[model samples]
Target: MSIVLIDSGLGGLTVLHEALQELPHERYLFFADNGNVPYGTKPKETVRSCILSAVQELVTEETKALLIACNTATSIAIADLRRLYSIPVIGMEPAVKPAVELNRNTGKRSLVMATPLALKETKYHDLVNRLGDTEHIDSQPMPGLVTLAEELEFDGPRVQAYLQETIGDRDWQEYGTAVLGCTHFSFFRTAFAKFLPPHIELIDGNRGTVRRLQELIRGREEAPDSAAAAGPVVEFRHSGSDPAYRERMEQALDWYRRDRERAGRPRA
Candidate 1:
């Protein structure tokens, strides 16, 4: 059986990249609903409906697990998905607790960067309250970074402009860590580093989600018996019939590979 990873656009590709490295034996089906891109800007009801429809269309009988890789969709639609799908459904959330812990460890402030919808979600507020004081936790809405990541223009002038505008000239030295609350933002970790001070750490939910999926897959005790077992494979699909979709995805994969190689890290 394959695993399904759903997102609004290229954001989920970041999650898929991690999954490919850590769960090399598993087959992945990445569904990008680019027709309704930027779920973070949509209304809660609209995002939920779109996510449900995407799941219904993408999931197959062979599907063993579903991972919602968008923070906006997960915050609003994850419960509905769990109720509807019998398979294990994993949802991506901001790494607020982890970032806050980093702050405590370093005796510096924690910052949480997310889309407007995620920043306003009750779950996010509760997470902040549980992990740290509201005054100490800095939550900012970064609605444009997702679009930059989708365009695969990381570490460029456009990205620098956007980060400068979004982050302003705040005393970044005061912050010890920044939590990337959106999967899309995870793709541009290096760009974010450029805008922040060197001491500030960056954390995201991509690796955590991959680990969670691995744990669930192991618990199921399922073995690969299908044709896909011959090798690791990733299937990409998008709601919009964009002719450049395949080309862009290939480019993204290449970038992912280069990043790993430059870091001198083997496949996780």
Candidate 2:
């Protein structure tokens, strides 16, 4: 069966990218809600509504399974989405545990750069809890980061400027391992490297998320062969965000198309 991945913004494709790499033989669809970017900051109820709407769209659009690639949305609404719809839903929790395990093996400190909501939401109680707030683990609030992600999506100049403005005055040099708590944050890895030393580590949980999806797919008897033609295509659905935001999102998507074509790479 075709796999469908849904994120509140374009960042979710980072997870989709890794999933495809592991299962290149599998057909897939990736949907990013660029219009509703930044689900982390929104209320739980609002996130639920938007996520439900997206799942409904996919169901009507003929997708078989759904992966909630956005961590914030997953933290808040994954269970409800599963209950409301028959489609299998996969959720994302912080990858701190894996990072911690990696750090202990490598001898490095772990610091998580996630949004405020991610830190505050106890509903995200399902956290792997592998690591603690010990010296190895540092969680901080960088709220407007999704905005920075949107900027990066369109190659906006504010990207570098925004990073410098946010991190220049701070001391991020202390941590060796940095967990990109949000999916969108994965796209800004290059810019983040500019601010961090080369030895610093950047860890993301997209791969783990994909593994869960694989397990779900395997359990489904009706699931289609991943080798079938990849007909599951995804698009942005801006329910009620700013018009300017929608325009910028469309432009960024166009850029993705052009770049993918030039590189002879399939859109992830």
Candidate 3:
């Protein structure tokens, strides 16, 4: 069986990266709505529509679950997805809980940096209220970070400038941790480090989200040894006419391949 991962763009691959690390035995299918990238700024209804359409197009009977890897989409439509689909529906959230926990004992402040909708949505507000100490949780809405990730500028002057422009004014010394609320933002960890102090930890939901997926799979019957030994295979689909989108997807796959080879892990 295969599991489906849906994202507004390439950002969700960060989650897919971790999923491959933790659950190498499962088949993974990824779908990106590049035609409508950056769901952060879009209207809630539009995001829901696009997500529903993607789910309808990519999910099949062989699919075991749907992982919504976009933070903005999770904040807006996760519940709707769970209700609409029969299979397990997993979603990502900013790692506010872990960030808050990391600072709770010391009474240090923690920051959650995300898109405007994620910060304003009730899903995040409830998450902060339930799992974190509200007093130490600071929310920062990053407007253009997603677009920068979409542009694929991983390092150098452009990323540095973008980080400096977005977070340069913040009192970086005060926070003990910063939760990366968007998956795209998670990809620019080095850029974030240039602006943040060494002591401030950066956290994201990728690993935790993948682990939860593992836990959900534990309840089901195991795949045959032949299937498990075959390892993970990622099938990609993009709902856009842009050739650049396909090229970007290929680049991401190649990066993963090279990293795995460097680590001496067996290829799928």
Candidate 4:
């Protein structure tokens, strides 16, 4: 069986990457809507439409389910998509529940790092409310990191500057646990560690996503390929106005994978 992980940009790759690590045998397909890289700031209607169209185009009947690997889309668009589509839909959520659990003893305020849209979305608000507001959660929106992550394939100093400027004194030295609310943010986990103390924890929501998907469709068997070895091959495509720019994006992503593998950054 095949599963499709859909997102508006490279951030979804983080979830895709993580899922591959956990569910090594599932045949997978990942489609990044790079034309609309950052979905956090878009209007609800626009984001919904974009995601719906991409999902329809990529999810063949042969696919087992869909994983919306984006926090902004999950918070705003998932419910609507589930109603219209018959396939199982799994989406990313902030790691507040676990972060608060770990933060109890350490007393460092729980840190939730996400895109501006993720922090402001309806689902995110509902999550906080569901937790009863008792936990001391510090929500920090790092918009520059994503914009920088896209360029880190090319510009390192710019990305570093953005992180240094954004994450000042009250960082790893302070927060007990930091949750990666955005799938794209997971890609820069290494650089993030540099900013955070060795003791601080960086957690992403991807592995949980895989476990949930496994529970949702437990006993099903399709093609032998689904139960075979995992191949972490990502096909990059761009629908931008500039052809050269699209090629550059693919090259950059390829470069990151190569460098990450060499640096011994864990890969799917």
Which structure among the candidates has the greatest TM-score? 1
TM-score of decoy 1: 0.93
Worst window of 10 by summed lDDT in candidate 3: 259-268
* Reference-based TM-score, model 2: 0.77
Model 3 ranges off by over 4 Å: 221-228, 253-268
lDDT of 1 by residue, 46-150 (tens): 988999999998887889899999998999999999999889999999987777766675677888889999888887787778874677788889889878877
Q: How many residue pairs clash in each candidate?
A: 0, 1, 0, 1
Q: Give the per-residue lDDT digits (tens) of candidate 4, residues 28-59.
A: 77777778878877787788888888887887
Residue-level lDDT for 144 in candidate 3: 80
Score residue 191 of candidate 3 by CA lDDT.
67
TM-scores, all models, native as reference: 0.93, 0.77, 0.91, 0.85
Count backbone clashes in candidate 4: 1
Q: Backbone clash tally for model 1? A: 0
Q: In candidate 3, what are the lDDT values of residues 50-109, reduced to their tens digit?
A: 988889888788888889999999988899888888888999998888788788788789
After aligning candidate 2 to the native by TM-score, how far in Å is the CA of 104 from where it should be? 1.9
User: All models: lDDT?
Assistant: 0.83, 0.67, 0.82, 0.73
Number of the candidate with higher lDDT, 1 or 4: 1
- Compared with the true structure, model 4 gives a TM-score of 0.85
Cα-based RMSD of the predictions, in order?
A: 2.2, 4.6, 3.5, 3.2
lDDT of 2 at 252: 55
